[model samples]
Structure formats: structure tokens, C-alpha cells
Target: MTNNQPSPDGILRLINGYWATGIVSASATHSVFTHLENGADTAADVAIRAGISERGAQTLLDGLVSVGLVGLRDGRYRNTAEASAYLVEGTPASLSSFAKLKLTHMNALADLPEVVRTGGPVKQVATEVADNPHWAEVVPAIAAQSVPAATIAADVLRLPEAGAISILDVGGGSGIYSAVWLEANPDARSTQLDWEPINAIARRLLEERGVADRFTCIDGDFHTTDFGTGQYDVALYSHIAHQEGPEGNVEVFTRLRKALKPGGALVVCDYVVDDDRSGPAFPLLFASEMLLKSKQGGTWRRADYHDWLIKAGFEDVSFHSAPPATLVVARQRRRPVL
Candidate 1:
């Protein structure tokens, strides 16, 4: 655990990492964080209120406290600020549903050995598109995790309050980012493109924020949809590019660029690998998760994005730091007609 030293072996960490993951998962699974936030401060209170055995309650509480995710004060347990900020229920920052979604993803790992042998995921990641309606919960939960990042992205774009400025949110699930941008730029309008169910979710978010009047909701896939040429002043690819491979991304980037008025920005925020691709950990593991989840999706390199953006006739590319992922900002090349 030396700072600046290489971590222990990969296999060792992967084997035991689930211990901590399970701890957080169990606490969230049993609504321990929610109960603590709602005033079930002691193990007995949590046990009684949550309908679990006192011994089981205490075990879970102690495990979370040991991991610094929970704090103890005067014999009462409390969620640490980090846990309250990101793990509690009924909050935009809450990732509780994301945790549950990943828990379901974990169910597929039992077939990993065969997946490796076969060179494809034996089990694909589940979706609302499946018979289950659970994605109705998961997509918004995933979007909540992106709100802060997307807010920063909007800040980077520095849009103005002009009705002439039009933006496109490609695969904008919850419309959090577009809603944020529209909030900032009252006169500007956006078109949110995604699937039918996801667009329904986005419409609700926009309506709740009172910005639905200014934003258009279109239900379709970005790959197949016709994003009108020279119509958009800005285009956002928020967390959606990670689902596309290099060539697929190039095609989408080309379409997004074609949609943008020359000099308009194309903003991409997604889990990406550094050029070395050695570690930053989450993105690397997310790459593997993508393999299991999609027929063709994985984290890619910064160079890959840079090249693809350029190939799509984009220029003035710049990188900006954001948490967990970086923003690749580029512009459609401004060329005069001959």
C-alpha cells in the first residue's frame, strides 16, 4: 500500500477486490446507507427497521466502517460524506441503482472461463430491451452518475444564451447534460437522440426541469438515424462513444461532424485509456465489462479518438481534464466552398 509504488499482482487484487465490492454491495443491497441516512443510527435500529437480524446488521455496518465508507460516532453508525453523496437513494448523485445493475452483471462472470475459451462473452449484459423492465431504473441511475461530469462538459463548451445556437445530445439518456446546458443557456435549444425508452426518460428529466419546451426528443439509434447536415451548432457524445469500436466511432463521428455547422464543437466524454493502456484501472476493467456487455465495445486510447476526429474532418482538437474520464473537444474544419 505504498504511495507511488506499483500495486500488488493483478490476480491477487482481482480475487480480493470483490470483498470490498461485496461489502459496499451488501450495504447498498440491504438499504443500510438509506436507513442510516433516515436515522437508523445504531445496529439494533438498523436491524429492526430494515427487518434483518441484529447480528447480520452489525456485521455489515462494521465492514463498511472498517473501509472508511461509514463512520462511527457515540455508538451510532453514519454514512460517510462520500457514501451519502454517491450511494444514498433518491438523490441525483446516488449510484445505488448502478450498483444493483453491476451486481446483475456480476451474475454473468460464472461463465467467464468459457467466454475466454470461446473469445466472446458467453453472457451479454442485460438491458431494458430485454423482457425485463429493469432498465427503466438502470438507465437513469447511470445518467445520475454522469450529471456532474456533463455539467463540467457544458461549462467547457461555454455556450451563450442565443436562440440561434442549437445542440444535439447523441444517446442522451436522462437528458441531464442537455438539461443542464439548457438551464445555463435559456434561449438555446437541443435535440436529444436515443432509443424510445431512453428518450422517454430524457423527456421526463427535461420536463421536470421545465426545459422540455426548448429541447426536442427523438427516439432512434445514432448509428442509423439521419442527423441533418449543417443543422447543429454543437453535438455531444456523452458516455456513448465507449460503446462503439474504432471504426464504428469513426462513422458516428463523421455523421456528428456532418451534422454540425462548421466550427461547431463535438464533445466526447467517456471512459478512455491512456496511450500506454497499462492502468487507471477502472477504464481498463470497464473495457472487459464492455466485451461481456456488447458485441463490439471497449475503452479506447486518446490517440484513437484524436485520429478518428481528424479523419472525420474535425480540427482544433483539445483535451480537458474531468474526473474518471477526459473530454476530447474538437471542431468541424471550417472550409470554404470552392
Candidate 2:
């Protein structure tokens, strides 16, 4: 092998990416980040604290060190600044819940080859929840990582004049949007609809945020639920449509049309693909993961959303200038009676 030979970037990235997954899984499984939260510890000490063999802990720590996610001082191991902030369990910035979700549902990744052949997520993910009750806990945990994105959704859903502004947050996991809106629009309150278990977490989060008194949790299947005709001044469906196929998308918007007051605004935040669906890596990657993890989910084009909005009686459908992920806002065509 010539030392001066140009590196093979494509093959190397694929090869190295697999190792990153293994490292993530190992650190999460051992709770290494949690272990190093306060300060560094020797490998043997970490093993004792975490109930693993000293040799195993040493190897894991060494791997973390090599990956630059952890560091060594003297003979002690510690999380790097980035890992310390976002992987430590109790930190507000922690994404440990998201990591745990991935670790718990690793079978999703393992079964990707089969999913490719069948062109669907394994039926069990949706249909066999009783056998997989663990998914209930994992789903809300996954949503917690996306709370920052929810803040953006809430900000856009703001109504200028608020005297009892009624809001509907559909499939609003963890109640982040409702929480933000209720905080900002003091007179405004919300109804958050999502799966029962996920809604439990949302209720708790809302209570913790001191907004539970202003919000109601509706634990039901949103597709079949009556979202209340002409009840809300604002409706938000954030990070949900892509998982529901085009037919479901139309059904949801149709429901929203009846739910909103005249001239009410609908705010949708999603990873929308360009009209051509050619690029923008996050949505494309998410699309692949969606295919691997959901039955009918796929990223939609921006134009498709405009068409859906128009079909559902929305006028002035427009995209936000910020964040290429696409924020679609539309107003009900009917003017509210003065």
C-alpha cells in the first residue's frame, strides 16, 4: 500500500459509519455518559459503578477515547464536553432518551434488509404493540429530542390577538408546541392528541411546565377522532404528516378544515423534500429511516403540501423563508364574521 495514495472517501465513510453505531450502542448500554457526568473516573471504578468487568469497561472507555467522545486524564476516563452535555441523563440538553429509544429498537436497523425486500416496516411496529409495549415508552423519549423543533412550530402558530385562542396540536408528541404556545399566549390553551402512553408523558411535561391546567390531553387515534368543528383558531400538525401517507395527509387536512374557525391558520412543520425530491440530506435520510421504521411514511414534496392545502379549502399556502425543512402555513378561505 502506497502511503501517499489518495484516500477512498466513499468506502471509508460507509465502513466507519458502522463503527459509530456500535460505539453509540455501547456507551448507551453502559450508561458511560451518566457515569462521567460529575467528573472523571478510572476504568476500574466505572466498571464497579456500572456493574461490568474492569477489563470490559477499560476496552469500552478506550474505544470511546479513540472516537473522541471521551477523554483520558492520568488513567481516568471522562466524557468529552459534547458528550457530557447531551448524553448525561439528567441534563436538560440530554438526548439520552433518544439514544435509549434507538438502543431499545435496534431491531429496526437489524431488520432493514427484510424491510427492503418487503418494502415496509415490519408489521409488528404498528399492529403488534401489545407484544412490544416497550415501544410506548420509547416513542415519547424520541420526541423529547425534537423539542427545539417544536418551539419553532409553536412560534409560527402564534395568533396576534388572543382572547381565548383555541388551539389543536395533532399528533403533538410530548406537548412541546402546546407548552410553548400556552406560555406565550396566556389566554390561549390547547388540546394535545396523541397515543395514550405518549400523551401520558405530555401531560407530565405540561404539568411540569405549569401549563397542564391550560391544556387537555386526548388519548385517541387521531385519524378516527372528531377534532371538533370550528373550535380552534389555530391548528398545528408538527413532524407527523410524513409518517402518514398522502391519503392520510389529505384526510388530516380535511379534518383540520372542519376543526378550525373561519380564517384560522394551520401550521405544519416537517422535513419536506424539494418538489423534485432530489436532495437535502436530513429529510432523505429520515425518509430512509421512515421506510425502515414505518408502514407508509415517506417525505412529501412542498408542492404536494400546497395541493393538499388547496384541496382542504386553504388559501395563501406559503412556505417559511427560514429552515429548508419547510414550514407550510395556510389560512382557511372563509372569512370570520365580524
Candidate 3:
């Protein structure tokens, strides 16, 4: 291999990476940070608040201290600055929900050796994953992870101020993208398509922005949902396509294109790896998680998205990417008379 390749030392670190992940997951599951933030500075206090044993709390606390996520001094423990800012509940940047959501579902990957041998999620099918009880956690986690990228993409969208523009957010889990657009253009309206539970999550989020009045929710899967023809000026597949794979994306994109007005636009936001599928660490790692949750899910490249968009009757496709997320914009290409 070339000199660019790192030594086996790097691979060793990666292989053992799950040690810290497991510790983080365990601590977050027990709400260790929340207890600390709520004045439970000692392991005894933490045990009382979190309903775990003092011994267990101390073990986890010191483990987190070793990882630098928790601070220890004078027989008391507290969140590190990073942990307090992002792990404690009720903070603007709180990632508590994300931690819970990821760890909850990652339980499915407990038998990694079996999955590797079977070449699929050996425990459960994709549909069986993320049960109803977890829906609340799922959407919040998705929102926290996605809204930053969605905000950036919405700005890049540069939506027109025209009163006639309407948007369709396909598989819009949290409605952040369309909500951002509605905020940008007061006259614009949006409709989000997702499952009933997910739509409920979207409603809460959009309501927070007072855009609920301008946003409509469709209760069904994007695959089976009827998106009225020529009804929308823009359609978004934000963070949606990666879970569907190529053929599924083409199918959904075709239907989305049909739902657009003659010259409407389509926007796709997702994690995109390079065409060679080699590096750009984030998407590559994300694909592994997808393998555990989805049958055909994996990250796509910008070029692949461009090709799919063109084939799905879109034109002038363009690409933009901020690491861990990429946005592809295209316009509906009305077909000529046969």
C-alpha cells in the first residue's frame, strides 16, 4: 500500500473503539450526566438519583473520568465541560436523546460475529427495528443529528420569495428542512410525508417553530403515499435516500418528480461518500451502522445521486457537501410529447 496508509496501530484503536462506546452508552442509559447536572456530585448521590448501586455508579463515574467525559475531585464527580454542554438533559446542544436512541437500537448488533457470518442483521429485519416506544427518542435524536445540516442546506437552497412555492418533504422525519424554508419564505407552505408516529414527531417540532399552521402532515410511508401530481414547487428527500439503496431511491425519486409542478425542484440531503467509496470517514462508518439496521442501506456518492436524479426525470442536478452530510439539488424535467 501507499505511504498514505496508517500503521496497524490505527486499526487496533478502531477495533477497541467500542470499549469507550459501550461505557458511554451504559452511563447515558443510566442518566449519569443528568444526575451529576442535578447536584448529584458524589457517586452515592448519583446512585440515589439514577436508582443504581453506589458501587456501580462509582465504577462508571471513574470510567467516564478516564475517558475525560467526567471530572473527579474531592470525592465528588461532575460532568466535563463537553459532557455538561452536550450530554446533560435540557441543554440546547443536548445529545442525551441521540445517545439513548443509538444505544437502544445498537443492542441489535450484540451478536456482531453472527451478523458478519450471515451477511445481514441476524436478529431482526429492518421493519422490526425501532419499535413504537422508541419513536419519541428516534425523532428527537434524528432532529439533533440532522437540523444543523438541514439548516445549512436550507440556506444553500436560496428559495424564492414567490407566494406560489409549495414544498413536499419526502420521509421528512422531523420536518426541520421544510420548517426552515417556511420560516425563510412566509408565503410558502409545506407538506411532510412520513409514518403516523413520525408525523407526530414532526408536528411537535414544527409546532415549536409556530410553522405547524403552514405545514401539513401525511400519515403513511413515502413509498405508498399519494403525492398529488404537479402540486409542489419543491420536494425534499432529506437524509432519506441512503436507507433505501439505489433502486428504491430511483423509484421514490420518480414518484417525487411526478408530484412536482412542471418545473419544480428536488433536494436530497444525505451522507455521501466519494465515488471510490474509499475514505471521508463519516459516511463510511455510517454505512456500517446502516448494515445493522437496513437491508440495502448504505451511503451513496454525489455522482450516483446525480445519475439517479437525471434518470428520475430531473435536470441541472448539482451537489454540495458538508462532511457527514451532502445535498443534491435538481429540477423536474418535463417530458416531451410521445
Candidate 4:
């Protein structure tokens, strides 16, 4: 009975908020947001466009409207501003398809309890595109959403005055960062490393973006392959570091450091928790996904990244915020003289 008072069980309400994610996933899978992209439409029109029963579509749209992902006016529906910007299929920021793909992995959600008990990716992630054809299909959309990620990396690259440059993009899906960089710096060339199918997607995207001539595709397991030391001026590990644990991340940067010229930069993009690990809902939810899927990965603190950067022989380490993510930049220290 302390003065804090029995306001509401806000935390429990949030925990129960898992239902909202399910609803969003359902609407996305049904293409509700895509249909709403052009303008508001009656539920019947939406159902026809999306090929769902109008009755069922109405239920889904109502749920979306209730959740503020869609808006209703005069018995017609439209995407909410946030949903239009980020959930519509053709929009540059569309992540609804990604959300739908993740929902297909709902089996992973079932293993959350086991992950908490054992810790680590409960199963090896299916790296083969055959095992998951969705990876290729989603790559373009994910790359499209990653413009901000690529832009931030380019900004970091602009800070230094390096001559002819070669960048190695590790796990670089769709060559998004390299594509953006190449567009900005005609002198820059890149090698995009990812699984074959993802690399194929990257190649297509690079070509469409008109930078394929300046890029190379490397297909292999980064964990097992030699990334080649002293070859690249920049190495990027965008949106993938948090998929591996601290030691795993350290191993990655260590290899990249070996691969870098003396002053090479490593740009990492991921959702980062504040050092306090208190809030910031996005990274926290991303951490929850890691909890279900990864044996070692979770959203990490900026301080933790700094420690790993130092241990990996990176000297000028710092963090910067971009929308929906934080970019970690670290430069390989000059090779120590004996």
C-alpha cells in the first residue's frame, strides 16, 4: 500500500500485448496494408483486392484500426501513417513482409521457454536459401528498409579522406550499404559476402541500382572462410552483430581487423540497449526475438560494443544514433610495432 498506488497493471498489460504482434502479422500476411497503400477503401474493396473474404477482412482491419496501425473513417479503412510508411508492400520502408516471414517461423516462438533454459540459438539458423526460400524473397524488401542503415554507414565513410577504396560487406544482404556508398562515392568498390541466394539478390539489387559493375559477390560461410587481411578500407557488419553473442562478435571483428588496412573502419548497425538496459522498446523486443532464436545473441549495450572494439584492436570507437538503430564505428588501430 505504498504511495506508488495501484494505478493499473501496466506491465502486465504490456506483457499481454503479444496479441497485437499476432494481429499485425495476420494483417500483413493478408496484405491489408498493401491494399490500403493507395487510399482509404471500404472493407469489401480491401477484401477483393487482397483476395480474402470480406467478413474476415473486416475482422482483421478492425483489429488493425484498434491497434492504431490502420484508420477507419466512414466505414472505409486506410493505413495509419506509421503503417503506410513502414508496412505497405511497395513502400521503401515496408517491413510488413519481413514481419510476415518472421511469423512463418512461429515455431521458433514455441521454443522460447527452452531457449531461456538452455541459452543460445536452439538450432543452427538455416543458412541455406533452399531451406528457406523466404530469405531471398525478403532480401529486397529488407534492403529497401535498410536505406537509413546504408546512409549512416556512408556518412561515417565520408568522415575520412581515403583514396581508392575497397569495402567488404560481411553478411551484407542485397548489398544495401555498398549500393548506397557506391552511389555516393564513384571511386568506391565493394565485395558483398553472404549466402548464395542472398548474394544473388544483392547482385540484382546492385545492378538495378546501377552499381553492379563496381561490386563483387562472395558466397561462403563468413564464420569458416578467410576474409583476407589488409585488403579492405572498410568492413561493414550491419544489422547482424546482435545475432551472435559477445565472444562471437569479438571473433568477427578480430577477423575483420586482420582483413582491414591499418586504418580501416568497421561499421556495425544494430538495435542497442542503453547502458542501463532500462527501456527503448524496439531493441528490447528485438532482444526477445534473440531470446527465442539465438543461443548467444541479444541486443547489447553500447559500452559492451566499445569493450569488444578495443579487444578487437579497434582504436577510435564510438556510437551514433540513426532512426530505429544505432551505428557502432571503430577503426582498426595501426598494427603495433614489435
Candidate 5:
């Protein structure tokens, strides 16, 4: 007789997830990927270049190899294509900083039990208070993560073909969408509304990308601030909905709908779960982060978005797949001709 029971392997992997995080974070911290890219093929070379012990370098490289981020052959190590593209420092698609940022966030997860018991964060660090300096460090790191999604959004909307469009990126953390859209359309201009500190980071980043002149920032909380009517051809609410409750999201969506010009599109990029919330593992896992950080935030479902957008006076709400994120595009209802 065969006993029916689930394998322990899956559970073991889930419990050991922190080990992978540690390995990646440590490697990124020591610039191991950068050293590997710079021709450090041996453990000793990596150790010397990254200023770690040879034993440590060997162990880290072995971990990276196991994780498929590094390749080992003939007693030599090299970055895999994925690592070369996204783990190396100064690469346009690099996520080294985001990796390092997650290391810092791991400590907060230790309070998960208590947070779940209490049904909210013990101490809220994810708020938009004036003195909060969290965004200063977080914005730029996440900018890299948003690149593919933002580029896809621009492509989906055909911003390049739109010609002379105006964009309002509400709570646009790093101004990446603005930067990408502006680059894709030379005649386009963007305005980002975020806290002053985050805006400062955005200004510097946009300036480096040579689009600062076309990017403007409004420093205020979106909750209380007015998103002017008929002011924008496109509006972006990216990675922000998960930090809000249903009421808050509806309110913001209503404001965004009003902010858009007639026929303008409102693009919402977020880690959206399926209607039944059965799978697409990342968004489900990410809900815990929201629980630990915000009082009323969670990974919302597709149905939730449809209801909110429709209630907010938007029409033709649709969802598009952008890996690591989902885009919900809605249009401002065009007024009928009298």
C-alpha cells in the first residue's frame, strides 16, 4: 500500500529560503558579481578583488552556482547570463542594490509572528510621514526592478507613437516611468508627485538620464493632495496599491480618473493576484510584506481592481501581464458630443 503524503522537499526549500537570500546579499555587498565580470575567474582572484577570504569567496561562489547565478567549470567561476545582466554593478538592468535592500528588510520579518498576531505592524516604517527617510534609500534600488515593467507599459500604450503626451506619475518613486516614457517620446513631458526627499532622488536620476528638463515633481501626499482634472494624457500608479486599503485605493483611483484628460489612460502597475487568489506565488507571498508594513494593505485581486476602477468612473478596465508586475489600464470616459 502506498501512503499519500506531500514531500518534505518543498517545505525544506521554503524554510531554507533565507540561505539563498543571505548568499545573494553577501555576494552583492562584496561586489562579487562585479569582480567576476572584471575577469576574476578563480576564488583567490575573487577574494583579493572583493576583499573577502578565499574560503568565503569559494563558498559564496559555490552558493551562487547552486542558485544558477554563477557558472563553474574547470576550477573557474563566471557570472551566468542572468547574473551578468542583472547582478553586476553599473549594468543598466542591475538589481544589486535591490538585493542589498532586501537584506535589510529580512530583519523586519523576524517580527512576522507578532505582526500577524496583532494584525498590523508593531512599528510602521512604510508610511509617508514627512520625516521618513526610507524612500530615499528604497526608491533608486527599486527603480531597476521597475525598468522592464515600465518599458512594457510604454510599449503597450505606444507612447512613442502618441506624440507630445503629458504624464502624471502619482507617487512615482524614482521617476523611472517618466524617464522611460520621456526617452521613448522626445516631445513628451512628465510630472512626478512624491515626497520631497524622493523627488530629490528622482530629479537627480532624471537629470543623469538627461530628461530632468521634461520632468517635474510635486511634493505632497497623494491622500490629501489634489490631482488636477484634465491635466494628463497618461497617469501611472505603480507599486503603490498594495500599501493601501480598499477605501484608500478607490479614493486614489477616483482622483486619478479625474486627473486624466478625456480618452487618457490610467496605468496601474502592481503585484496583482488572480481573482480567486489561488496562485501566481509571488503576489501571494508579497501580501505578508504588506501585512507587516501597513495597517490595511494586501495583494489585491483582479476582481477588486475591476470594482474599484469602475466605481472610480473609469471605463474599459483591462489587465496586462508584465512579469514581476501586472498592468491595469483604464480609460477616462470621453464626454459625449452635445
Candidate 6:
């Protein structure tokens, strides 16, 4: 005989999800992964380097081992491959900052029930308010997450071969796309439009990457700012669409269409859901974060994007997969031959 009843194991794990979050966050905050990568094999070594008690370091190491982010053998600890690649402090794809950022965002989950009931965030942190301090911290952390997707987008567009191209990055947080594209095509120049505080952060990051010479910033709200006419060869709206409603997105797309030169491409990298509102897991789950943080934001469908792009005077709209996100590329229609 077999039981038909569902097991409580899944429910238990869901409720205890914060345990995993806390472990990762604490480990990142204490630089456990970095220390491990730097030859700290014992908890004592890690504790010495991280300035924590040996017992505490041991417990944290055990927690990390349990989560498969760290490995333990012969009573010694080491960062797992994934941890070394992404959790180390200065790796090209480091996510240490992103993990630490989540520790701050985790507090907002407590208000989910109220937010759902009220149909909006109780107090929005993901918006443009003059000198919004949240952007200063969150922007750089998210830039790491965008690196892979930005590289993919740049490759797909053959940015390296597209010499002397002009790029317009709308609401370009942290300026990762610009950095990647500029690095790929040394002759390319990119402009970013965003809040002044966020632009300040982007300037510092681009300066560090040595791409500041090719990058410029327009410090203002994108909604009110003029994108200018027929100016750019490529335009990017990376990771900003989900924080807006349909009308807002359509309006922005219209402006971006005008901002592009004839036949210019606009690349929108975002967590786009399926037409039927089914799951690719992460994007579907990310909708909850948008709901908890934004007044009118959610993972939109591909169909929604197609409709908006078409309505906004774009042609050849298509989608491409860049895991954990999607790229919706649309082109401004070219003029007819005489």
C-alpha cells in the first residue's frame, strides 16, 4: 500500500527558507568564502582572519557545508567551486555584495501579507526620490548579477564588431551594460540616464573599470527626461521594465523608439514571464519581490512585451534567453528605399 497524502517536508523547507538565507548572508558578511579561498582551511584560521570566535566560525562553516557552498574534508574547510567563483570578494562574477544586499531586503518580506492586502508596498524603497539612499547600496550589488546577461546581450548584438556605436542605457543602474559593451568595442560610447545618486555610483564603478572615458550620465528621472531623436545606434533598458505598469512601459518604449536611429536595436533585459503566466521558477518568484517593493511592478509576459513594442512603433521584436532573465530585442523601423 502507498500513501496518497502529501508530505510535510516541502512545507517545512519553505517555512525554514530563511535559515538558508541567513546562513549565506552571515557567511558573506563575515567573508568566510573569501578567507577560505585565501588558504584558511580551518575554522580557527577563518576566525582569526574574520575576527570571530572559533566556535562561531566552526558553526558557520558547518552551515555552509550543509548548503554545499563550502566543503569539509579531513576536518578542513574549503570553498566549493560555486562559492569560489561567485562568493569571493574580487572575482569577475562575485556575488558577495548581492548576498549582503539581500540581508537588508529580507526584512521587507515581513510586510508581504499587508502589501498583498493593500495591493501595493506599504512604503516603497525601489523608487525615485531625490537622494534615495537605497540606490547607492543596491545598485552596485545588482551590477554583479547583470554581468552575465550583459555579456550575453553584447555578444548576441556583436557589439565588439560594431565600431563607433552609440548606446543609450535607460535607467541603467550601476552601468554594467555600458561597461561591458564599451570594453567589447573600444570605439563605442555609452550614455546612461538615471537618478543623480545612482549615476554617482555608476561613475565610480566605470572609473574603477577604466571605462569612464567612454561613459556619460544624464542625471534625471527617465519618465520626464528627453531621450533625444534619432541619436543612438543601440539602446538598453536593462532590468527596469518590471518596476513599471503596462502604460508606463509603453510610454518608455515609445520614447526609446524615437531615441534610436533608423534600424537601431533596443535591448530590454528583464525577468519576463511566459505568455500563459507559467513558470521558469526564478522570474515567477521574482514577481513577489516586485510586489513587495513596487507600487505597480510584476514579471510581465512575452506577449505583453510584443504588444507594447509593436504599439510603440518598433518592428522585428523577438526574445532571447539569458538565464535568470530574458532579452526582448526590438528595432526601430527603417525608412523605405526611394
Q: Model 4, 214-261: lDDT tens per residue?
A: 999888878887899799988889888877878889999999989998
* CA RMSD (A), model 6: 1.8
Per-model C-alpha lDDT, please?
A: 0.82, 0.77, 0.79, 0.81, 0.91, 0.91
lDDT of 3 by residue, 1-338 (tens): 47797678767757777667777878888999988988899988989999999899888897898779998888888898989877887764577778766655656657667766666676556444434666666777767666556666667766644565888998888777777778878888999988888888889888998988899988887777788888998888887787787998998899888888887788888889889889688988887776776777788887889899888888789777755787788886676879
Question: Can you rank all candidates by TM-score, best first?
Answer: 5, 6, 1, 4, 2, 3
lDDT of 1 at 217: 81
Which clashing pairs does model 3 show? none
Candidate 4 clashing pairs, residues 3+ apart or interchain: 120-294, 120-295, 121-294, 121-295
lDDT of 1 by residue, 1-338 (tens): 58888776776756876666777887788888999999999999999988999999999899898779899988988999999998998886788877766666566777767766666566534531423476587777687778777778777887643456899989888888888889889888999998887788888888998999998988887778999999998899977777777888999999999899877999999887889998667788787666666666778888889999999889788888776778889996677989
CA displacement after TM-score superposition, residue 280 of candidate 4 (Å): 2.3
TM-score of each: 0.87, 0.80, 0.78, 0.85, 0.95, 0.94
Misplaced by over 4 Å in model 5 are 1-7, 333-338
Q: Between 1 and 6, whose TM-score is larger?
A: 6
User: For model 6, what is the alpha-carbon lDDT of residue 247?
Assistant: 99
Pick out the ten consecutive residues of candidate 1 with the lowest summed lDDT: 123-132
Give the distance in Å from residue 47's predicted Cα in candidate 4 to where it truly belongs: 2.8
- Compared with the true structure, model 4 gives a TM-score of 0.85
Stretch of 10 with least lDDT, candidate 6: 124-133
Cand. 6 TM to true fold:
0.94
lDDT of 6 by residue, 137-237 (tens): 88888788888899999888999999899999999988988988899999999999998888999999899999999999999999999999999999999
User: Lowest lDDT 10-mer window, candidate 5?
Assistant: 124-133
Worst 10 residues of 3 by lDDT: 122-131
Error of 4 at 262 (Å): 3.7
